[model samples]
Target: MDDSRAKGPPADADINLTEPAPVEASLTDNPQKLKIAYEQTILYARDLNLKIGELKQAEKALRQNAADLAVLFEASQVFLSQNNIETTLQTACQLIVSRFDLQLSWVGVLTNDENEIHPAAVYPPHDHSDSHPLNQVGASSAAGQELIRQAIHTTQAVASRYSEPEARQAQPAALTDDAYSLAALPLLHNGEVLGVMSVYSRQPDYFTPDRLQILQSFANLTAVALVKARLFERLQLLSQQLVDAQEAERRHIARELHDEIGQTLTAVKINLQAMQRRSGVSDLTASLQESMDIVEQAIQQVRNLSLDLRPSLLDDLGLVATLRWYLDRQARWAGLSTQLTVTPSNLQLPANLETVCFRLVQEALTNALRHAQAQTIQVDLQQHDKELQLVIGDDGLGFEVEPTLKRVAYGKGLGLVGMQERVSLLGGRFELESAPGQGTQIRVFLPVPPALAEDRSA
Candidate 1:
């Protein structure tokens, strides 16, 4: 064969075609296609780059979402920690402005006078310095007042972009000029609108739908706190009224006893003394003296009864003197050995507080004399560091303390329940310690009002 014809193709063609075609390679044994291999490598690199970019974007979004959730949780904790109304609103405003980075945050309650809204609390605009004049108007001003009105009227949350002229005009100059975003959320509980909360930001569209929803949740918590505060106030008022009524009734009864029964006893004693003075035989004289003694005893009994109803000693002398007189008389009458120790004598207390203290002492002594087969009793009173301390102990056969508190038969006559009630009214703590074969001791701790302790020694 000729060499040129045997080569099958020209040298240029053979050199240019470095790899066999797919169909030719399949027919043959092997195929080395470098161009196709290089093209496949380039396509894989492009796909990898695209996947990396997508992953970076997804991570950024996830981080932002986590930050938003953390802020919401912090705001919720702030709302739950407040126990009073004023503090609750203040906390809410601070959280909104600080955590959410808003320019201004405030809360307003609908005024009783249907036309006005009262600003309760506000966080000043972010750019305003603490000493700036504009910072002073967070709680009181025309801007704050009107914002409240708009929130109340809408009843639903309102979010508006500052670029809109209508929205700009509706807002206050301080807010519109300095704040580019604003949102108002209504506070509702049990289908009733209590107030509205408003927030502002320096950047337009700063507050998203998710942020508004979180703010609304804060408003709901505020409503519950306010309701609780109001209810507590009402209860305090009612309790004071009841106390005033009780005092009035006591005064009325005291007057009746002094005017009616007291006068009658005085007249009876006078008549008996007059009869004895009249000339009489020896036998008649002895009989008349005995009758006069009996009349005098009756007079003393009437006086004691009047005192028990309401003690005049409480007003005439201080708590110590009154207690001393009461214990002396009861101990002598009941045939019980009683020792009273009151340190820092002549100390004075408020009339109501004194009355409570006296009654507690009186009841405790009475119970010991009547029920406890004790030989000796001790009453101690002292004052220490803004508190009044009382301890009454008796060397009698002690009984179970729990059963006595429950008024069980073994402790029926202890009067623990009555003593507990009296202590509670004064916002004091009462404790009783007793066990079989041991003496019983009652302890009372009462807080002294600052007004009473001012300028006084403990």
Candidate 2:
């Protein structure tokens, strides 16, 4: 091949193959310089790595902060809207699991036992079940359980990590480096430790001290809400008792009027009639007849008062019969046409439930007749599934329902509020619908106990 176009290497005759290759003048020529250069490069890499690590930590912190805020905002909204304790706790658990994308979350309350806590609620929103209500704490996740105890005992937040196998095995066993995270936060409020709430995540070290602090804030809110809920429930119970007392008082007064006063008035009227018949003088006869007429009016007034206070039919004849009689009498007095319907006409209910039902209808009718200028009123009652339903309607000049109820709630009027309170105290749902130039309608749904429903059905 031609030398100019050849691709192969030159002939070996011109090269020194046996001799050592020449050294280039560079840092390698001096051990000191080479070491210094290598050290400098290492230093540069170390500094860069440190800065990068710090930035990553800062970014992670910001992301975690945003997540914490989102969780708190959503939970606070629920806390603001719902005042019921069970609802608040249940919703809080759901929010935590949903927000954190957590594996599970559970709430443990102070039980009779001082050494351990009991599960009050769990995540995934169970169907009113106790099976696995404790999620992982009751059975395993030993590290988590200990942390829960420590958090509750100290009223502080305790955190740890656990692997899936460790969690599933649920033994109070040691955990490995690679594991899920668990944070036990105390439900501390008013300087009292009510219980503990624990959350789990697949991401190890997810609940850092700062993250736990944010969760603790939510736990604190949940604790306060629980206290408020407890107080509210107690208040509801007292209010229910108050209503029951009022009903009893009314019954007592009605009985007194019907029995004692009615008899006395009747006796007086009979004596007056006897006196008028036996008297021969015209003046005396006229006087006696007037006295008898007054007695008759007095007797009629007493009877009306007795019925209005508390009708005997309410107790002796059940809710349906009592409602029929009450609606009829009120309709006649107000010159309104009343239509009442009851499925399974002989429907019977518990005494307290019957009283509540009767009172609700009574208030609705009174409001419709006295305020609505309604000429036709309808009352419907029926039992369906696990609840009793009642609907009352009237063709009257209706007013704004919300404003009226708000005013009533603020003590402006009791007509609308009394109806609502009566239903609420019994843990029932009450809704009012009305508008100007439109007739009013009141809908009520009262939960019936399973046992009571069975009895009624039988």
Which RMSD values do the candidates have, in order? 12.5, 11.5
Summarize candidate 2's per-residue lDDT along 1-458 as a digit string, tens digits: 23442222243223222222333468577988666555545544555555677679899989879988988888877787676777878888888888778766788778656566777777865444333324444323466678887887788998876666665464223323346677888999887888889887767778877778888998998988888888888999899889889989999999999899999999999988888888999999998888888989999999999988899998888888888888888877888898988976877788999998887887888777678889999999999867999999999998987788779878988776788788888888988889999999889999998997887767
Clashes of each: 0, 1
Window of ten residues with lowest summed lDDT in model 2 = 11-20
Q: What would the TM-score be for candidate 2 when compared with the true structure?
A: 0.81
Judging by TM-score against the true structure, name the best candidate: 2
Q: Give the TM-score of candidate 1.
A: 0.57
State the lDDT of candidate 1 residue by residue for 353-374, as single tens digits.
7877887888877777677787
Residue pairs in steric clash, candidate 2?
140-170
Model 1 alpha-carbon drift over 4 Å, by segment: 1-111, 114-146, 157-218, 276-298, 335-346, 364-454
Residue pairs in steric clash, candidate 1?
A: none
